[model samples]
Target: MSVLSRLFARHVKPEFGKPGPRQEGGDLPPHLYGVIAEFGKPETLVHAVHATRKEGYQVIEAYTPYPIEELHDAIGHGPSRVPLLVLIGGIVGGLFGFFLQYWTSVVAYPLNVGGRPYNSWVSFIPITFECTILFAGIAAVLGMLVLNGLPMPYHPVFSVPRFQLASRDRYFLLILARDPRFRAGDTFRFMETLGASLVSDVED
Candidate 1:
Protein backbone atom coordinates (compact mmCIF):
# COMPACT_ATOMS: atom_id res chain seq x y z
CA MET A 1 0.00 0.00 0.00
CA SER A 2 1.05 3.58 -0.60
CA VAL A 3 2.24 5.73 2.30
CA LEU A 4 -0.87 7.90 2.19
CA SER A 5 -3.13 4.86 2.28
CA ARG A 6 -1.15 3.33 5.10
CA LEU A 7 -1.35 6.48 7.17
CA PHE A 8 -5.09 6.64 6.63
CA ALA A 9 -5.42 3.01 7.60
CA ARG A 10 -3.74 3.72 10.88
CA HIS A 11 -6.26 6.46 11.63
CA VAL A 12 -9.46 4.53 10.96
CA LYS A 13 -11.34 5.99 13.91
CA PRO A 14 -14.48 7.47 12.33
CA GLU A 15 -15.35 9.96 14.99
CA PHE A 16 -13.21 12.96 15.94
CA GLY A 17 -13.58 12.38 19.66
CA LYS A 18 -11.77 14.69 22.03
CA PRO A 19 -8.50 13.57 23.48
CA GLY A 20 -6.67 14.67 26.63
CA PRO A 21 -5.10 18.12 26.46
CA ARG A 22 -1.35 18.56 26.25
CA GLN A 23 0.68 20.98 28.34
CA GLU A 24 -0.04 24.46 27.04
CA GLY A 25 2.90 26.39 25.65
CA GLY A 26 3.73 29.94 26.71
CA ASP A 27 4.60 31.43 23.32
CA LEU A 28 1.40 32.54 21.57
CA PRO A 29 0.46 35.41 19.28
CA PRO A 30 -1.93 38.10 20.43
CA HIS A 31 -4.51 36.86 17.96
CA LEU A 32 -3.64 33.29 17.24
CA TYR A 33 -5.48 31.28 14.64
CA GLY A 34 -3.58 28.04 14.90
CA VAL A 35 -0.33 26.23 14.26
CA ILE A 36 0.52 25.27 10.69
CA ALA A 37 3.01 22.64 9.62
CA GLU A 38 4.82 23.09 6.35
CA PHE A 39 5.68 19.97 4.42
CA GLY A 40 8.06 19.70 1.51
CA LYS A 41 5.94 17.10 -0.26
CA PRO A 42 2.25 16.40 -0.78
CA GLU A 43 2.67 12.88 0.62
CA THR A 44 4.03 14.25 3.84
CA LEU A 45 1.15 16.69 4.07
CA VAL A 46 -1.41 13.93 3.60
CA HIS A 47 0.36 11.83 6.18
CA ALA A 48 0.25 14.67 8.63
CA VAL A 49 -3.48 15.16 8.10
CA HIS A 50 -4.28 11.55 8.92
CA ALA A 51 -2.12 11.70 11.99
CA THR A 52 -3.81 14.85 13.23
CA ARG A 53 -7.24 13.44 12.52
CA LYS A 54 -6.33 10.36 14.47
CA GLU A 55 -5.57 12.64 17.38
CA GLY A 56 -9.09 14.15 17.13
CA TYR A 57 -8.04 17.45 15.64
CA GLN A 58 -11.21 18.06 13.67
CA VAL A 59 -10.77 21.79 13.12
CA ILE A 60 -7.93 21.46 10.68
CA GLU A 61 -7.40 22.32 7.03
CA ALA A 62 -4.77 21.80 4.39
CA TYR A 63 -3.31 24.05 1.70
CA THR A 64 -1.35 22.99 -1.32
CA PRO A 65 0.14 24.64 -4.38
CA TYR A 66 -2.31 22.70 -6.52
CA PRO A 67 -5.22 20.36 -6.18
CA ILE A 68 -4.53 17.01 -4.56
CA GLU A 69 -7.32 14.49 -5.13
CA GLU A 70 -6.46 12.34 -2.13
CA LEU A 71 -6.31 15.40 0.08
CA HIS A 72 -10.05 15.91 -0.35
CA ASP A 73 -10.89 12.64 1.40
CA ALA A 74 -8.24 13.31 4.02
CA ILE A 75 -9.87 16.64 4.85
CA GLY A 76 -13.27 14.97 5.40
CA HIS A 77 -15.10 17.59 3.37
CA GLY A 78 -18.86 17.20 3.42
CA PRO A 79 -21.66 18.17 1.05
CA SER A 80 -22.30 21.88 0.59
CA ARG A 81 -25.61 23.55 1.45
CA VAL A 82 -25.36 26.18 -1.30
CA PRO A 83 -27.79 24.37 -3.59
CA LEU A 84 -30.49 24.37 -0.93
CA LEU A 85 -29.97 28.07 -0.26
CA VAL A 86 -30.22 28.87 -3.96
CA LEU A 87 -33.43 26.89 -4.35
CA ILE A 88 -35.04 28.67 -1.40
CA GLY A 89 -33.96 32.05 -2.78
CA GLY A 90 -35.43 31.26 -6.16
CA ILE A 91 -38.74 30.19 -4.66
CA VAL A 92 -38.93 33.36 -2.58
CA GLY A 93 -38.12 35.54 -5.57
CA GLY A 94 -40.76 33.85 -7.70
CA LEU A 95 -43.38 34.39 -5.02
CA PHE A 96 -42.36 38.00 -4.58
CA GLY A 97 -42.44 38.65 -8.31
CA PHE A 98 -45.86 37.10 -8.73
CA PHE A 99 -47.31 38.99 -5.76
CA LEU A 100 -45.85 42.32 -6.85
CA GLN A 101 -47.36 42.04 -10.30
CA TYR A 102 -50.63 40.75 -8.89
CA TRP A 103 -50.95 43.60 -6.41
CA THR A 104 -49.98 46.21 -8.99
CA SER A 105 -52.28 44.99 -11.76
CA VAL A 106 -55.22 43.20 -10.15
CA VAL A 107 -55.53 44.99 -6.80
CA ALA A 108 -54.10 48.49 -7.14
CA TYR A 109 -54.47 49.66 -10.73
CA PRO A 110 -57.11 47.16 -12.00
CA LEU A 111 -56.62 48.64 -15.45
CA ASN A 112 -59.29 47.45 -17.82
CA VAL A 113 -57.27 47.35 -21.03
CA GLY A 114 -58.96 46.08 -24.17
CA GLY A 115 -61.74 44.52 -22.08
CA ARG A 116 -59.20 42.15 -20.58
CA PRO A 117 -58.97 41.19 -16.93
CA TYR A 118 -56.45 43.07 -14.78
CA ASN A 119 -55.08 39.84 -13.29
CA SER A 120 -53.30 38.62 -16.38
CA TRP A 121 -51.54 35.66 -14.80
CA VAL A 122 -50.05 34.64 -18.15
CA SER A 123 -48.22 37.94 -18.61
CA PHE A 124 -46.57 37.51 -15.16
CA ILE A 125 -44.75 34.37 -16.33
CA PRO A 126 -41.82 36.15 -18.01
CA ILE A 127 -41.11 38.49 -15.10
CA THR A 128 -41.56 35.73 -12.56
CA PHE A 129 -39.11 33.53 -14.45
CA GLU A 130 -36.57 36.33 -14.66
CA CYS A 131 -36.88 37.12 -10.97
CA THR A 132 -36.40 33.51 -10.00
CA ILE A 133 -33.21 33.29 -12.01
CA LEU A 134 -31.95 36.61 -10.65
CA PHE A 135 -32.48 35.71 -6.99
CA ALA A 136 -31.07 32.22 -7.40
CA GLY A 137 -27.96 33.62 -9.01
CA ILE A 138 -27.53 36.14 -6.22
CA ALA A 139 -27.97 33.45 -3.56
CA ALA A 140 -25.36 31.23 -5.15
CA VAL A 141 -22.75 33.98 -5.12
CA LEU A 142 -23.47 35.17 -1.60
CA GLY A 143 -23.79 31.67 -0.20
CA MET A 144 -20.43 30.67 -1.66
CA LEU A 145 -18.70 33.71 -0.22
CA VAL A 146 -20.31 33.32 3.19
CA LEU A 147 -19.73 29.60 3.38
CA ASN A 148 -16.10 29.92 2.36
CA GLY A 149 -15.53 32.86 4.74
CA LEU A 150 -14.51 35.19 1.97
CA PRO A 151 -13.91 38.95 1.93
CA MET A 152 -11.22 38.09 4.45
CA PRO A 153 -8.31 40.27 3.34
CA TYR A 154 -6.12 38.86 6.07
CA HIS A 155 -5.72 35.47 7.72
CA PRO A 156 -3.21 34.20 10.26
CA VAL A 157 -1.99 31.57 7.79
CA PHE A 158 -0.89 34.35 5.49
CA SER A 159 1.11 35.78 8.37
CA VAL A 160 3.65 32.98 7.96
CA PRO A 161 6.60 34.23 5.97
CA ARG A 162 6.94 31.06 3.87
CA PHE A 163 3.17 30.72 3.37
CA GLN A 164 3.46 32.66 0.14
CA LEU A 165 4.94 29.50 -1.31
CA ALA A 166 1.53 27.88 -0.89
CA SER A 167 0.74 29.33 -4.30
CA ARG A 168 3.97 28.03 -5.74
CA ASP A 169 5.16 24.61 -4.57
CA ARG A 170 4.50 24.11 -0.87
CA TYR A 171 1.98 22.02 1.07
CA PHE A 172 0.69 23.06 4.47
CA LEU A 173 -1.56 21.57 7.13
CA LEU A 174 -3.08 23.80 9.80
CA ILE A 175 -4.45 22.68 13.16
CA LEU A 176 -6.70 25.28 14.68
CA ALA A 177 -6.36 26.07 18.40
CA ARG A 178 -10.08 25.51 18.72
CA ASP A 179 -9.56 21.78 18.47
CA PRO A 180 -10.13 20.13 21.83
CA ARG A 181 -6.87 18.25 21.70
CA PHE A 182 -4.83 21.25 20.64
CA ARG A 183 -2.22 22.35 23.16
CA ALA A 184 -0.15 25.18 21.75
CA GLY A 185 3.24 23.89 22.84
CA ASP A 186 2.54 20.19 22.55
CA THR A 187 0.81 20.55 19.19
CA PHE A 188 3.84 22.29 17.72
CA ARG A 189 6.01 19.42 18.89
CA PHE A 190 3.54 16.87 17.52
CA MET A 191 3.73 18.50 14.11
CA GLU A 192 7.49 18.44 14.17
CA THR A 193 7.30 14.72 14.86
CA LEU A 194 5.11 14.36 11.77
CA GLY A 195 8.21 15.02 9.69
CA ALA A 196 7.20 18.57 8.86
CA SER A 197 10.10 20.59 7.54
CA LEU A 198 8.81 23.69 9.32
CA VAL A 199 6.16 24.16 12.00
CA SER A 200 5.19 27.74 12.73
CA ASP A 201 2.65 29.48 14.95
CA VAL A 202 0.01 31.31 12.92
CA GLU A 203 -0.83 34.68 14.43
CA ASP A 204 -3.93 36.68 13.77
Candidate 2:
Protein backbone atom coordinates (compact mmCIF):
# COMPACT_ATOMS: atom_id res chain seq x y z
CA MET A 1 0.00 0.00 0.00
CA SER A 2 1.08 3.57 -0.60
CA VAL A 3 2.24 5.82 2.25
CA LEU A 4 -1.02 7.71 2.26
CA SER A 5 -3.06 4.53 2.18
CA ARG A 6 -1.05 3.16 5.08
CA LEU A 7 -1.49 6.36 7.01
CA PHE A 8 -5.25 6.13 6.64
CA ALA A 9 -5.27 2.44 7.49
CA ARG A 10 -3.57 3.21 10.77
CA HIS A 11 -6.52 5.30 11.96
CA VAL A 12 -9.39 3.19 10.62
CA LYS A 13 -11.57 1.93 13.44
CA PRO A 14 -13.13 -1.50 13.03
CA GLU A 15 -16.52 -0.09 13.95
CA PHE A 16 -16.70 2.34 11.01
CA GLY A 17 -17.45 0.56 7.77
CA LYS A 18 -15.11 0.86 4.80
CA PRO A 19 -15.86 3.55 2.24
CA GLY A 20 -18.17 2.42 -0.54
CA PRO A 21 -17.33 2.36 -4.21
CA ARG A 22 -17.74 5.51 -6.30
CA GLN A 23 -20.93 5.92 -8.36
CA GLU A 24 -21.81 8.21 -11.20
CA GLY A 25 -24.68 9.49 -13.35
CA GLY A 26 -27.85 7.54 -12.55
CA ASP A 27 -25.99 5.30 -10.13
CA LEU A 28 -25.11 8.26 -7.89
CA PRO A 29 -27.49 9.58 -5.26
CA PRO A 30 -29.19 12.83 -6.27
CA HIS A 31 -28.24 14.52 -3.00
CA LEU A 32 -24.50 13.88 -3.24
CA TYR A 33 -22.72 17.21 -3.58
CA GLY A 34 -19.18 16.75 -2.22
CA VAL A 35 -17.09 14.87 0.35
CA ILE A 36 -16.36 15.81 3.94
CA ALA A 37 -13.68 14.41 6.23
CA GLU A 38 -14.03 14.73 9.96
CA PHE A 39 -10.93 14.95 12.12
CA GLY A 40 -10.70 14.34 15.84
CA LYS A 41 -8.41 17.24 16.56
CA PRO A 42 -7.42 20.64 15.20
CA GLU A 43 -3.82 19.57 14.55
CA THR A 44 -4.98 16.67 12.43
CA LEU A 45 -7.32 18.96 10.56
CA VAL A 46 -4.47 21.34 9.81
CA HIS A 47 -2.30 18.51 8.59
CA ALA A 48 -5.10 17.23 6.41
CA VAL A 49 -5.63 20.66 4.91
CA HIS A 50 -1.95 20.98 4.06
CA ALA A 51 -1.84 17.50 2.56
CA THR A 52 -4.96 18.21 0.50
CA ARG A 53 -3.51 21.46 -0.78
CA LYS A 54 -0.25 19.77 -1.70
CA GLU A 55 -2.32 17.35 -3.78
CA GLY A 56 -3.45 20.33 -5.89
CA TYR A 57 -7.05 20.56 -4.73
CA GLN A 58 -8.06 24.20 -4.79
CA VAL A 59 -11.74 23.90 -3.96
CA ILE A 60 -11.27 23.01 -0.32
CA GLU A 61 -12.78 24.45 2.88
CA ALA A 62 -12.28 23.76 6.57
CA TYR A 63 -14.41 24.34 9.65
CA THR A 64 -13.59 24.34 13.35
CA PRO A 65 -15.44 25.12 16.55
CA TYR A 66 -12.95 27.82 17.42
CA PRO A 67 -10.37 29.81 15.49
CA ILE A 68 -7.09 28.22 14.44
CA GLU A 69 -4.73 30.81 13.01
CA GLU A 70 -2.50 28.16 11.49
CA LEU A 71 -5.42 26.71 9.55
CA HIS A 72 -5.72 29.92 7.55
CA ASP A 73 -2.11 29.56 6.43
CA ALA A 74 -2.56 25.84 5.78
CA ILE A 75 -5.60 26.59 3.57
CA GLY A 76 -3.73 29.37 1.76
CA HIS A 77 -6.38 32.05 2.29
CA GLY A 78 -5.30 35.39 0.92
CA PRO A 79 -5.35 38.55 2.99
CA SER A 80 -8.80 40.07 3.39
CA ARG A 81 -9.75 43.26 1.49
CA VAL A 82 -12.19 44.49 4.16
CA PRO A 83 -9.59 46.90 5.59
CA LEU A 84 -9.12 48.46 2.17
CA LEU A 85 -12.86 48.88 1.82
CA VAL A 86 -13.06 50.50 5.23
CA LEU A 87 -10.22 52.90 4.36
CA ILE A 88 -11.90 53.91 1.11
CA GLY A 89 -15.18 54.47 2.91
CA GLY A 90 -13.50 56.56 5.55
CA ILE A 91 -11.71 58.74 2.99
CA VAL A 92 -14.87 59.34 1.00
CA GLY A 93 -16.87 60.16 4.10
CA GLY A 94 -14.22 62.50 5.46
CA LEU A 95 -14.02 64.39 2.18
CA PHE A 96 -17.78 64.61 1.85
CA GLY A 97 -18.20 65.77 5.45
CA PHE A 98 -15.39 68.27 5.20
CA PHE A 99 -16.69 69.68 1.92
CA LEU A 100 -20.24 69.90 3.21
CA GLN A 101 -19.05 71.77 6.26
CA TYR A 102 -16.91 74.07 4.10
CA TRP A 103 -19.77 74.78 1.70
CA THR A 104 -22.36 75.39 4.43
CA SER A 105 -20.21 77.34 6.88
CA VAL A 106 -18.49 79.54 4.28
CA VAL A 107 -20.82 79.86 1.29
CA ALA A 108 -24.31 78.44 1.98
CA TYR A 109 -24.91 80.21 5.32
CA PRO A 110 -21.96 82.27 6.40
CA LEU A 111 -22.52 83.12 10.08
CA ASN A 112 -20.71 86.35 10.88
CA VAL A 113 -21.49 85.65 14.54
CA GLY A 114 -18.33 86.81 16.34
CA GLY A 115 -15.90 88.17 13.74
CA ARG A 116 -14.28 84.73 14.00
CA PRO A 117 -12.99 83.01 10.86
CA TYR A 118 -15.84 81.71 8.67
CA ASN A 119 -13.63 78.84 7.43
CA SER A 120 -12.93 77.50 10.91
CA TRP A 121 -11.44 74.07 10.15
CA VAL A 122 -11.47 73.34 13.90
CA SER A 123 -15.28 73.23 13.95
CA PHE A 124 -15.30 70.82 10.97
CA ILE A 125 -13.33 68.26 13.02
CA PRO A 126 -16.35 66.92 14.97
CA ILE A 127 -18.56 66.27 11.94
CA THR A 128 -15.63 64.94 9.95
CA PHE A 129 -14.77 62.49 12.72
CA GLU A 130 -18.38 61.36 13.00
CA CYS A 131 -18.74 60.82 9.29
CA THR A 132 -15.47 58.91 9.08
CA ILE A 133 -16.54 56.58 11.88
CA LEU A 134 -20.02 56.05 10.44
CA PHE A 135 -18.85 55.26 6.94
CA ALA A 136 -15.97 53.06 8.05
CA GLY A 137 -18.22 51.14 10.42
CA ILE A 138 -20.82 50.58 7.71
CA ALA A 139 -18.19 49.57 5.21
CA ALA A 140 -16.58 47.14 7.65
CA VAL A 141 -19.89 45.44 8.39
CA LEU A 142 -21.18 45.36 4.81
CA GLY A 143 -17.83 44.57 3.31
CA MET A 144 -17.38 41.61 5.67
CA LEU A 145 -20.84 40.32 4.85
CA VAL A 146 -20.30 40.65 1.12
CA LEU A 147 -16.83 39.16 1.15
CA ASN A 148 -17.79 36.26 3.37
CA GLY A 149 -21.11 35.67 1.53
CA LEU A 150 -23.08 35.98 4.75
CA PRO A 151 -26.84 35.87 5.35
CA MET A 152 -26.59 32.35 4.05
CA PRO A 153 -29.46 30.66 5.78
CA TYR A 154 -28.53 27.39 4.16
CA HIS A 155 -25.46 25.54 2.96
CA PRO A 156 -25.11 22.08 1.44
CA VAL A 157 -22.47 21.13 4.02
CA PHE A 158 -25.15 21.25 6.66
CA SER A 159 -26.83 18.30 5.02
CA VAL A 160 -24.30 15.92 6.55
CA PRO A 161 -25.73 14.48 9.78
CA ARG A 162 -22.45 14.63 11.69
CA PHE A 163 -21.61 18.09 10.44
CA GLN A 164 -23.61 19.55 13.30
CA LEU A 165 -20.65 18.61 15.48
CA ALA A 166 -18.53 21.04 13.49
CA SER A 167 -19.84 23.90 15.58
CA ARG A 168 -19.26 21.91 18.74
CA ASP A 169 -16.19 19.70 18.85
CA ARG A 170 -15.24 18.06 15.56
CA TYR A 171 -13.16 19.81 12.89
CA PHE A 172 -14.04 19.24 9.23
CA LEU A 173 -12.28 19.39 5.90
CA LEU A 174 -14.29 19.44 2.70
CA ILE A 175 -13.24 18.67 -0.85
CA LEU A 176 -15.68 20.26 -3.25
CA ALA A 177 -16.71 18.42 -6.42
CA ARG A 178 -15.99 21.48 -8.51
CA ASP A 179 -12.28 21.12 -7.88
CA PRO A 180 -10.32 20.31 -10.99
CA ARG A 181 -8.42 17.54 -9.25
CA PHE A 182 -11.53 15.90 -7.82
CA ARG A 183 -12.47 12.34 -8.64
CA ALA A 184 -15.07 10.77 -6.38
CA GLY A 185 -13.10 7.69 -5.50
CA ASP A 186 -9.67 9.27 -5.55
CA THR A 187 -10.58 12.23 -3.39
CA PHE A 188 -12.46 10.03 -0.98
CA ARG A 189 -9.45 7.79 -0.53
CA PHE A 190 -7.15 10.78 -0.23
CA MET A 191 -9.20 12.20 2.60
CA GLU A 192 -9.29 8.77 4.22
CA THR A 193 -5.50 8.79 4.25
CA LEU A 194 -5.49 11.94 6.35
CA GLY A 195 -6.63 10.09 9.47
CA ALA A 196 -10.24 11.20 9.23
CA SER A 197 -12.47 9.74 11.94
CA LEU A 198 -15.37 9.76 9.52
CA VAL A 199 -15.51 10.44 5.79
CA SER A 200 -18.94 11.05 4.39
CA ASP A 201 -20.62 12.60 1.37
CA VAL A 202 -22.06 16.08 1.42
CA GLU A 203 -25.44 16.63 -0.20
CA ASP A 204 -26.77 19.56 -2.13
Q: Residue-pair clashes per candidate, as listed? A: 0, 0
lDDT of 2 at 2: 81
TM-score of 1: 0.80
Q: What would the per-residue lDDT of candidate 1 be over residues 153-203, giving only the tens digit for each residue? A: 666677799999999998999987767677778888989999998999877
What's each prediction's TM-score? 0.80, 0.81
Residues 12-128, candidate 2, lDDT per residue (tens digit)?
311122222333423444445679999999999998998999999876889999999999888987777778879988999899889999999899999985887999999899999
Question: Candidate 2: misplaced stretches above 4 Å?
Answer: 1-32
Model 1, runs deviating above 4 Å: 1-31
Can you give the lDDT of residue 43 in candidate 1? 92
lDDT of 2: 0.80
